[model samples]
Target: MASSVSAAAKASAAFAHKKELAAAAPAPTQHRAGSGRRSKPCRVRAVASPARAPRAPSSTGSVKTAMTMTEKILARASERAGLEPGENVWVDVDVLMTHDVCGPGTIGIFKKEFGGDAKVWDREKVVIIPDHYIFTSDERANRNVDILRDFCMEQNIKYFYDIKDLSNFKANPDYKGVCHVALAQEGHCRPGEVLLGTDSHTCNAGAFGQFATGIGNTDAGFVLGTGKALLKVPPTIRFVLDGEMPPYLLAKDLILQIIGEISVSGATYKSMEFVGSTVESLNMEERMTLCNMVIEAGGKNGVVPADETTFKYLEGKTSVDYEPVYSDAQARFFSDYRFDVSKLEPVVAKPHSPDNRALARECKDVKIDRVYIGSCTGGKTEDFLAAAKVFLASGKKVKVPTFLVPATQKVWMDLYSLPVPGSGGKTCSQIFEEAGCDTPASPSCGACLGGPRDTYARMNEPMVCVSTTNRNFPGRMGHKEGQIYLASPYTAAASALTGYVTDPRDFLM
Candidate 1:
């Protein structure tokens, strides 16, 4: 890794410290997550049955006559009645996904709770993806997959992405990406659908305009036997991001700022309905990044209203016909906040918490030892494209050790062949390889969780890193001593190049 910045960058003083700018500012929102507001029981709107509740006119302020995305999707899944906030209804699940880390435990609970002879509620709806900890050298990890595989065979579950890809990396075309991405790839996640997964990031699928959320093992076991889950319609909090993001800004930054503003638990148990032109402008991948982190804000789910971009991503990629639901104009929000995207700076969540954030430029000089640029949160073609653009401009390699994960095999295939924006005849992986970095072929959730011993990029030594992956909770990526700073893929790349935390704008042309 290079030890110094390019001559052009040194002269720019992009990392110059400004104490005033670094100071944390008073929050600009009313419901800031951990801002010491008096704890209050979740605001429960009075329960109303579908028969009694009528669709409100667009101009009406009555929530009873309106429906938020969560209410609409849950009501349909209920199949028996309409749903409103605070109403606990048994909603049928469209799909249920579990990865290796949680699958074995979930299966155990299923058998213990439903009896040994009971089979999965619907074999076709259960999708298994052995991702987290699958690559570990531990026999226990491999055995977990064996357990899942055996169960799938016995139950006739077909939507299973096994450890097939680990053999040749490109061996299995059926080995979809991460559980969340694979779900979307296979069309299991769709607008107006209700999906559940053991992964908290399952909310990532909510970008498709669905009511997707994470569940615990007990809930998974229950759903396994019944294909139904009990969920109270969550009140929706709308974030209307206005204005256009600057060229250097990305969705990761926008989300970090939101979490930073709201505190990690700011939106606890509420549906985050992201609306605004800026949100509409984000591509499907970016929108997914937005929803993926809502859990960080203590949200029940995160969603963007399905639009052209959402459909364009699913067109031809999925055979499942889907219905798209939109929040009624009269849908009432628990609380609303508007942020001008153009005014938002690239932000990073500091160590130990997702909401302990600050402007990336303000912390530009903080030295880093590691950089990671892939995870379900930041690993995508668009994310790699942003990183490649920065690397191409610097005409340099990374100064710190960096890892590039492609989120899935399909994404890796694209990076393996994608030409760097301006680099002469070089692929994305080639650019990183040339910069004295490593690009692993097989993609899975690596280091995002401090996985088993054999997990690649697992932090063994105490080192500071700027990563594109979500969450910075202590020990989230690896060793508890290893501090993590969360930023955009662009920031990850820029920081890798400079050996210090950096604002991507420093390298943007």
Candidate 2:
């Protein structure tokens, strides 16, 4: 597990010295690989389809008109660009992202389909980031990354090798982890843009108010070769949350409660919109965590109507000045869902599935062996503070093993500056260090996705483990034989203190 970070450091250093030169180089109008057939320039459009004519009223005298965010974007893209849902329309992509596990696959496909003999559709529209398998603990993983590095150089890909910081390798400056998080900080992802990546969590970009989604390796290959894809417009489901969240609750619980209601597949092939008072109150980090896991519930992507929270996080990070965009006042949705945080309690998802959720109180007596407090989902700053606060208030040490991992280098970089509730709020990481918690700041896929660190040593422990990761599938974290529960950061922390499946409400009360 540690080797992944080590390998990444080496890769980062090798690539660090070239950032200045790369940045200074003028943007190329032609493909670096010199593949594919060069074609005429194509015009870009926001909406690809036109609005449908109004339908005639039925005998009931009521007309129906509703559309989802995904539908609206695709419809608009199609109408304005003259593209049908299934038609392969070649266009410039706003952002292109690929990682190690899939980057080589995409690169290979690109070479085979369009290399040397043909001209690429667009070169400036691509980005390559190595994650998922940054560390090569095995011969195969090492070879995979080597192939990727070579291919990137050949293609002149603007690669973030080994999560390097252009020139400041020692300062680290938080450029080590998942592609989405890296892209967010590097200004590759922006609002009102379309992004496609080779990873499922590519939807993570929705946090930036962009139309981002994931596709399979084959799909990515096609897009890499032709800069075009066929898309099926998705329906949108709206969530209007009102009221305030108590100390024990936050965005993770809100999403869990939703999964409990909608089931894992309830929102299949649909886009989800998280809005209203509750959403507005959430900081950008919290919103990002929520939106990052929307796909786990089988939705195309999760989004929020851009507001102050969104603007504040993106102000200086984007290439262009921020211009907020929101759903039209008359924007249509397939169905509307509402949540009241004031009345909500801690929610947990049972193991082997994310949809098997129940209130924490429903299973208070369950025993726990391990507690994890990080992942791309709940490993952000807000999550750390919430968990540390509970531990500090109780002045208790976790009786069971607990693991805390920061999603990206940036997260760890800020962990020491977090303000505690009182005493003007001490850094949560300091408190965690004092509390005897194993809080290590490392890259993505650490424990939640079984990347190698802190794996389960025994099977059938029957211990109730609490985690903040997106899914709780069989053997997801460490072992299939061990029992696992998914909860908000507060809930996981509360359980950590008690060494039993405990309700976070107890600490708050």
Q: Which candidate number has the best lDDT?
A: 1
Per-residue lDDT of candidate 2, residues 1-509 (tens digit): 11111111112110121111011111111111111221211212243222333554464354433333444355444444222223333333566788777877877787787765544455666777665654435556556767766766666665454543323322544346666677776676665567889887788778766667888878788887777766765556666677776767878888887776667775667677777677778887787777787787777777765554555566566545333234434445555665667888888998778878888888788888888887668877678888888888877788788888766667666777767686356788778877778865465555666654433222234456888878888777656676778988888988888887778877767
Candidate 2, superposed: residue stretches over 4 Å from native:
1-68, 75-92, 116-124, 159-175, 321-325, 423-425, 452-463
Candidate No. with top TM-score = 1
Q: What total of clashing residue pairs does each candidate reach?
A: 3, 21
Q: What is the alpha-carbon lDDT for the whole of candidate 2?
A: 0.65
lDDT for predicted candidate 1 compared with the true structure: 0.78
Per-residue lDDT value at 417 in model 1? 86
Residue runs of model 1 more than 4 Å from their true location after superposition: 1-64, 165-167
